[model samples]
Target: MNIKEKYEMSKKEYEKWGLDVDKILEELSRVKISIHCWQGDDVTGFEKTQNALSGGIAATGNYPGKARNGEELRKDLDKALSLIPGKHKVNLHAIYAETDGEVVERDQLKPEHFKKWVDWAKKNGLGLDFNPTIFSHPKAADGLTLSSPNKEIRDFWIRHCMASRSIGEYFGRELGQTCLTNIWIPDGYKDVPSDRMGPRKRLKESLDEIFSQKIDKKYNLDCVESKVFGLGAEAYTVGSSEFYISYAARNNIMSLMDTGHYHPTEVVSDKLSAMLLFNDKVALHVSRPVRWDSDHVILFDDEIKELSKEIVRNNALGRVIIGLDFFDASINRIAAWTIGSRNMIKSLLSAMLTPNDKLKELQDTGNFTERLALMEEFKTYPMGDIWNYYCEKNNVPVAEKWLDNVKDYERTELSKRS
Candidate 1:
């Protein structure tokens, strides 16, 4: 049957559970996913003295058509965003600064370095988010950043982070949206350390110094990210989940949870609900983890659906800031972005279309049998029909048709890149 016909049939099915499909679509449009910019360039920012991928993060594969500069990365994003439905914010790192061939040190970075990004964001009516890049730098060679025992190293990173907040403030002032400036450090030892407390103490002091400046919350929102462990720092990570969670709670800032940054058994889906219950606001980096903390593209899988469901059911949609964080250089960069971005939006739509209240009532009433049955049956619902209709309405391609656009771009635009 045609898309509209299928959608009408699906709408009737969902309406059986007292769902408003039209309202769901309207709600979906208002939620924005912050698409990561590094995915277009494999985390190789436009720094003059670029270093090898470090901090336990690596983007494998020598994709032939990776964007080499800021202009090309932005062009690639234009194509990806056009294919993906709705307007969203672009997440940028400190290393992505446009310094006009001048070697500007990270600690001394200013807002003018990102004037082009702000201008482009203004032209496209897209919001912007900032991240302080603490990995893959000379200072972080020992895999120790803020937690380093060396006073000079810790102080330098402190300045860089402080400078990063100023840039975030600029973005907010320019785009009229509060910029989320997230700090993620890769400071840990390869083996067991005798003095874990020392590093944690240093990290705490560095954070206090970085946040000492009282930037207005209207212009910039501060965030701290934590990790279970990483490549070089297998034994211990200074910014452990416990540390940041406590710090954020006490400091009244947002705590960021990256899906891939946690242990293998832990799922971010459950954490979302718990975080929402206690904190006023929490940020999420939606990424897939393969085996360990391997940053893989996000999929519309069971976990993501659960994650989205928590946000909707708990009424925490407005309290959470969602962003994508995965980089793979193995395939077409634009297509990677398209697949992940589309899946993120699709997963959220699926959750919104679900009969959450009915299932919750069943569970609360001790009707586990009916709850399980309905949950399983709901999986077979005709979400694709409604999705295709949403894409058509949004002026984007339906189903697999979007991939055709990516292929055309590869031949005409990406293939020409070095």
Candidate 2:
């Protein structure tokens, strides 16, 4: 039978278990996943530089057809968004600003620099998110930014972050929605440091100075991200997870958790409930990490399913800001975006389609054996039928047909990049 007929059959099966398939689809339609812009250019922003990547971050691989400029990057983003089904937003780094053939220092950046991006987002009917580019600059060559012992360096980064917040406010004010401005500095030592406390203290003061001016939260929400370690900062990272979580809780700001930012054994799914308990809202940088902080493209894997289940089970979708954060220059950039994005949406849909209420009831009534059995039985549900129907409803290609579109685009557009 067709997808609709199969979905109808699956819908009836779910109905018998006290689940509403249509309601789940409706909820999934409303979710807006923010796609990162850096994926198109392998984290290489529009800046005049000839140095290796700094800030404890590196983009591996040299796949051809990387976006050469802002126009091409936006064009690539447009193509990727067309294939994805739901409403979405674009996440931009400060370095992506369009400077009219003139050099603009990070500290001197103004909202006018990003006026083109705001206009583009408005035209495309997408929301905008912002981030301060603290790495890949001459000042960051020493692998320290906000936490630098050099007063000049610390002040420069502080001013840049503060300016970024203003730009974020501008995006929100112009677009009629709050913009999330996230701060993640790659400031740590490659070798063991005897003065870890000193650097952290400096970082705290710098953050306080950057946030001294209180912008309205409605226009711009501030978020701080923490990492366990970075390439050179493996021995010591000033902005550790513990520091940011405490700082965010104390300052009433949002804490962002990058899935690849922690130890391999630690998962963000288990941390969501704790974050929701303390903070009014939280943010996520969803990416796949293999062994280390290798920002591989996302897949519909076990951790992703569990992460989505946590969000659905707690009903915390409204409180969580979901955004993609990976750059794989080894494959077609547009395909990387589409595949990772679709898989993210698929995982969420799977979670929404689950009979969580029934399973919770089974557990609440102390029926452990039945709960395990029902959970396993849910693995066999006809999720593909519902997913295909969702794609059809959203006017996107269903099943594996999207691969054809990507291949055609590569042949006509991406192949011509060189």
Candidate 3:
């Protein structure tokens, strides 16, 4: 038996106990999720995002090209605002300044640009999802490891942090909500060991400095999704699992779990512990995992097929804020992202609707023996209901009756568990 069989058995037991299957389906289906527009390649233009019929867009991108010429990016932003068809619009990325190597250019920052963004947010009622990447003059070739040893490099990084905080403060004052100044550092070790402990120390220091400037209000650092990787497994120094968690815990920062960041074969239990321990600090980066490759695939297949159920288990469900991490460099960026988002919502709905109270109960108890037993029972069970929910949610109506048959079968098998 495997997980599917166990779930089926549990679903049957739940139905017998009078669980409202439709309500469960509706609750799961109604869960709110949002994704960044940058995840897809075809997301370069504005028209593709402004959805009038469905939900408004969640976008994060480099300021429109006009901003570079000392021209206003906010005007383009205003134009984009007019394009959105819904009441809620979100900007998921922001960069205050650009820094590369030893050179830093702070003089070009027109405080007016900040004002423009805030004004736009007020008028359009948009939520900003800010990022602290590529905000300085010296471009990070190796990425912001936050552990650099050089004083120049360290100061450069700190400047970007300050700029991000300034923008957050402004947004907080105006919008009554602080922008989530999210960070995803590419800083890691490669090949040789270098003495950079002092510079590495600046990571927390910079963050603290920015946080301290807040005036009688609150803001969210939305835990940084750290990863440790290099071109050829030379040895990553930053964003590795251990370092990220430890640093986050020590610095009073939250943890946002990106499924693609973990070792592909990590056990579901371990993933649960990581999310639960950091539950209050948790935010999910919704994407599929394949062989340590964070390919932002359309998540309906083997990639995220079963793992999503594991996520909702162990009480890590409600804290989820889904997003697409698919890079634009992949396939038809637009179509892939649109389909991926649709599939992701469908997947969550399917998992949300599963009537496996027993399996959920077994998961909560933390008893290894029972867990193994449930896993065994899940092996041969046909979870056609799960498939049907997924299909129906995605508008494939033909699977409705097929799903009913599967649910009946599951209920029958579940009776044996008691």
Candidate 4:
């Protein structure tokens, strides 16, 4: 059967469940996820002098043909964007700035450093997001950036974050979309800490100093991400989930919840509804973790499906700022982006196709048996047909066929990186 015929057949099945297939697919296409830039370079930025990956962050394997400069990274992104379905934005770290071979410190950075990125984004009709790179710097050598005891170190990072917010504002103004500037610092102790309060207190003060000058939130949205533990900081983390959630609530900023930043059993899907109740907006860095924050490529698995269901069923798609955050240097980088992106979109579509209203009605009326039964029954629905149709409609490769293009690009473009 043809793709459209299969889609028509599947559409009948879902329409019986009270779903509008055409409307859902159109909504899915409009969803714009933010793709991270560091994945193309394995978190290695285009700094004149680079620092080793630290702060409990590391991208393994020596993948050849990693983006060596801003131009190469942008080209690689263009290739990946072509293969992935739906419109999306690009996320950039402060380290990805272009300095014309001059030494540009993080604290002294300006938007002009990222003019090339802004120009490329404008040409491609893509929005830009920003991140303050708190890791992989000498000042953060001890895995303490914003929460560092040293006043100089704290002040330096404060300045860097402030600069990042301004750059984010510039991106929003240039692209005509609100740019998200997310701050995630790696500051904690490996073993038991003697004075946790000291670090938290200092972190709050540093944040206060950095945000003292307010830029309009219309152009740039500010957010803080927290980690329960990191590679080096196992015992205790200064920016725990509790700390950031409280801070964001009081300061009126978004709190970024990274899927891989929490405990093993603690799922982020459960937090979305609660977060939406209190905050006007929230952000997410969708990632898969093997055990700890391992940052494996995102998979369309149970956890991801549940996460997407939360967003779709709760009608929080507009309020959630979605972004991808995983870098694997083992396989082909472009393929990594394509696979993860397609999976994320697929998860959202699956969530939309589910009979969420019926399920809620069952739960509200104490129909547990039917609720569980229908939920498991929908698992075998013709989702693949819908997904293939959506990909064909978007003019991207369907299913695993996108891998062929990735391999071709690897031979034609990446293999000749040297």
**Quick one: best lDDT, which candidate?**
4
lDDT at position 103, candidate 4:
97
Error of 1 at 56 (Å): 0.7
Which order, best to worst by lDDT?
4, 1, 2, 3
Better of 1 and 2 by lDDT: 1
What is the Cα-based TM-score of model 4?
0.99
lDDT values for all models: 0.92, 0.91, 0.48, 0.94
- Model 3 whole-model lDDT (C-alpha atoms): 0.48
Kindly list the per-residue Cα lDDT of model 3 for residues 177-296, writing each as its tens digit: 655556665555556556445434666565555455543337434456655453433364455666557766776666666666666666333465555665464555666555554445
RMSD of 1: 0.8
Model 1: per-residue lDDT, tens digit, 1-418?
A: 8888999998999999999999999888888899999999999999999889889998999889998998998999999999999889999999999999999999999999999999999999999999999989999998888999899999999999999999999999999988999999999988999999999999999999999987889989999999999998999999999999999998899999999988899999988888888899999999999998877898889888889888888877788899999999898889899999999999988988889999999999999999999999999998999999999989999999998998999999988977
Model 4 agreement with the true structure over 1-418: per-residue lDDT tens digits = 9999999999999999889999999999889999999889999998888899998987988778999999999999999999999889999999999999999999999999999999999999999999999999899998888998899999999999999999999999999999999999999999999998999999999988878868878899999999999988999999999999999898988899999999999999999999999988989999999998989999889999999999999998899999999999997899889989889999999999999999999999999999999999999999999999999999999888998899899999999997
The clash count of every prediction, one per candidate, is 0, 0, 29, 0
Error of 3 at 119 (Å): 7.6
Pairs that clash in candidate 2: none
Better of 1 and 4 by lDDT: 4
* Model 4, runs deviating above 4 Å: none
- TM-score, candidate number 3: 0.64
